[model samples]
Target: MTAPAVTVRTGMLDCIQANLALLADRWGEPLRHLALGAHLRFRPRPGPDGLPTVDPPPQTHIRQARALIGLVPRHVHHDLEPEALRALSRRTPVVYAVGDTHDMPWLPYAGRARMEHSFLVSGEAGEACVEDAYDNETAWGPARPGRWRLPWEQLPTARTAVEFTAPAAYRAPRPAVALDDPGPYVQAYAAHPDRLTALRRLTSETWLMARARHLHAAYREHRGESPDTHEHLRRWDRLTATAFIALRRAERGRPVPDSLLPDLAAALHADREVFAVRDEQTEPPDPT
Candidate 1:
């Protein structure tokens, strides 16, 4: 039998988003298991000379998913490589990791591929997955069914290896968006650390209706006029709810997963259950 090619090489461009843009986009495609979607990207930007610059872009590929799902971190954290494998199982039957190995060469994992039908992660980053079964890969290796790690020098004399910074879009909040330092608006708008205060305030039951009334009444009492009845209490409610949620989450920790944050944000949309009031139960907390 003929042996498979031991090495593979492609332009930095194709390798850039190919894993995520092409492979991870849909069925028959590979999926990304990133936890905290940082600035790490393969997309290039305009360079100083106005030419297409494929050089390294400013980015941070966070090894873990994130400290919080919605202003709070999960109780337990995960390593890098494993998270991606687990996330891919949701849509496709298999998962493949191309880069980011600590001490070795490029590594690809197929044994841990997940079938979307049976995926069931309780409360971990989608990227927060099973650690690679093999050692950390360094470069590229022969293409195979499972992880393939290689070194830059291992490439055939004819093959060459180049390096560049990949571009990316920000999905999860990073250190820059710290929660403790931001003000009320940020606390309300973001899910960063500043958001911890916001989430906590929201789930803690601040009674924004009364606060609004108080603010309005104060305005009325002072101006001898009606309250601000614009019904634009969303911002205020969001702040309260977010803070409360943050506090509760900080105390107990753990939310669904990073992938689910987008869906959760869509559902909240400043709804009463999510923002204005707790969606749990009006009857009261069940005391066991």
Candidate 2:
């Protein structure tokens, strides 16, 4: 007999959001947005021609995922393996970050030979099941059996692996839509001496300036070119730029220069607005 599949939600960011929501009737902590741009990591550097350019390092998504996970609950563990899988509760799902897979339909990165994906896992009657938003419609392997079965050989590269479990009596407060100021978020992250060192290295003056140029160039190349994919690329460029700026400011000290703050804020707002519009466009029309 086939094991029943667990609930799986998809959408790039919604995958994370839905999992967090599943963890509680409602989460206690607010999801912080230094800017949706910041979450996306939009860096506006100037090019040789003095135009804003955009380019993000390969690990941008992983880095952003790491930073954003701060908003969720504290229960987390690293590449601990089948032990982590065995420990998942039917009531709470465990989110796993792993290497790429050719099996998932929604991920363009699916065929890549590197670590860059995530999904949830649960168990029913001693049989483990994988629940993934991206693979919701794709039936293969364990998913064929109505339970999630991941490629066991690829597990080693997984990082930021976490399981969400709370005491029966524990309940969290509602999450905030946005933080009043992103300074505290930056400050807290930078306060960690080791992380601070890492951020400084990643946000060097020359690197950031070049990153800005790359981002703008990439955005221009893709803008308005393809209706289905153009906006996603645009969003990626914007997010990459935001990540660069946020890190650069954190490295320089929390307060961004006054002259630069308004522009950054505006860019951030623009990123959010575009995303809202794009999401609305893709959403299924209401029956009413």
Candidate 3:
């Protein structure tokens, strides 16, 4: 079967956001709102060494964000036969989560190692069209974004599929809302009870925080806000990188300076100060 032509763009920081962006683009919807409310929720779990390790927030965050933008994702757990998937693709694109990336020829991980990943699938009949916009450094190599066709025999490797549906009041092109204040979020991170565990989690999940900052920056750009917002992006990158390096050194049993956490807290305080000033400047005059 011949696959239909498709075009995809890469800008999001991860596969989930990228696929959602693709779906929004295809449906003529606005996605800048996903960048709103950029904050992190720290939920630490016991690691193999009995120390608390941080895990990225659950899928509920994605669902809530999507709902705000008028998209609802339905996740189907039972694996669907290749033929059934093809039929479903004929209707809408599928966001597939595969157990092993090694089976996906288009990914850098193919033939190198097994890693759970997600990408968009569409088209029907002969070959399944796959679109992945996650272009980043991975354990295997740099994963580049592109579109390709997978033979029906190879499509069944997907463990779950997510399809998006709109409500009865669905509207295209939702307007970008006001940016949430960043002061509270910065304070929360700085004042966490378990500073060591928080820093360790930040080491691995820094990308998540960095991406949120990127998104917020994008939203500010879209609204023609002050270019100063971009400065926050760089600050977040530096903050995350510093934490990552410190944690790596500790993990290697190297001497880490005692001032590391205090420095991070000071940086967070500075961020809160900047945001507070920006908020004050953007605030409207009181109407007496």
Candidate 4:
């Protein structure tokens, strides 16, 4: 199948966004999937006839602020990184992050890592906690405290070591609304079909990848380690974005991107747990 053409032009990013329609329909899970970097990549490997090779890029894929913006063409420069996100919720003391595979309707966070108690961090008045459950995938949040922890190795023994990071323009946007709905603004502005569609897809993929990154960022914050742009976050979002664009292209009878095949196959399990990418690479969907 063909992938949608994702030309990154400055501003005027909204043209076609069926993904938004689908996401808005199934907002909650899809939103978390986006935060977790599910099917958001814009360039997938090519199919047998026309495929692109993808190797998940090198490890430590710190999302360059510029690259990530290119991937989704959104306006979330500051909220993409951990430190910047924490600042947004300075009053959201104790952000509960958790995940599972039951396809839970609400999940605070998503990833294949864990958070240790040592990493449980507290700001002047509030606390930011991340829960990355391995082999677990659920979509629900407002997590209960102590529901999860980071691995011991990733946590910092000293609270003083924790430091606020510069706001990054290369991370996922935090949950704009507690529930799936895009709140008042989304509902208000959705009538603009073309733009509405684009935002929906962008929202779904963005939300999922962020959910996953939150886990890792929390660990780094706990360990008092500085995050180096989260390279993995960019690659992750790229892969899913590719798949999403390709999926849309195919639905419209278009040509898939060169990387559609390889990247589609490489999608992380946590990313796929919620927004399952429907393509030839995945096992045949159960016909229940």
Best by TM-score: 3
- Model 1: per-residue Cα lDDT over 128-228, one tens digit each: 22112221221234322123333222211111111112224423222111111113322233444444443433332233222422332332233333324
Candidate 2, lDDT over the whole model: 0.37
Scored against the true structure, residue 169 in model 4 reaches a CA lDDT of: 39
Worst 10 residues of 4 by lDDT: 9-18
Rate residue 272 of model 3 by lDDT. 46
Better of 3 and 4 by lDDT: 3
Ranking by TM-score: 3, 2, 4, 1
Off by over 4 Å in 1: 1-213, 227-230, 256-288
Let me know the TM-score candidate 1 reaches against the reference structure: 0.18
Error of 4 at 129 (Å): 25
The worst-scoring run of ten residues by lDDT in candidate 1 lies at 114-123
lDDT of 2 by residue, 57-159 (tens): 2234333322333333345555545555455444454554443455343344445433244555656556555654332222122222133454443333334
Pairs that clash in candidate 3: 1-126
The residue-level lDDT of candidate 3 at 56 comes to 28
- TM-score (C-alpha, index-matched) for candidate 2: 0.35
The alpha-carbon root-mean-square deviation between model 1 and the true structure, to one decimal in Å, is 22.4
TM-score of each: 0.18, 0.35, 0.64, 0.23
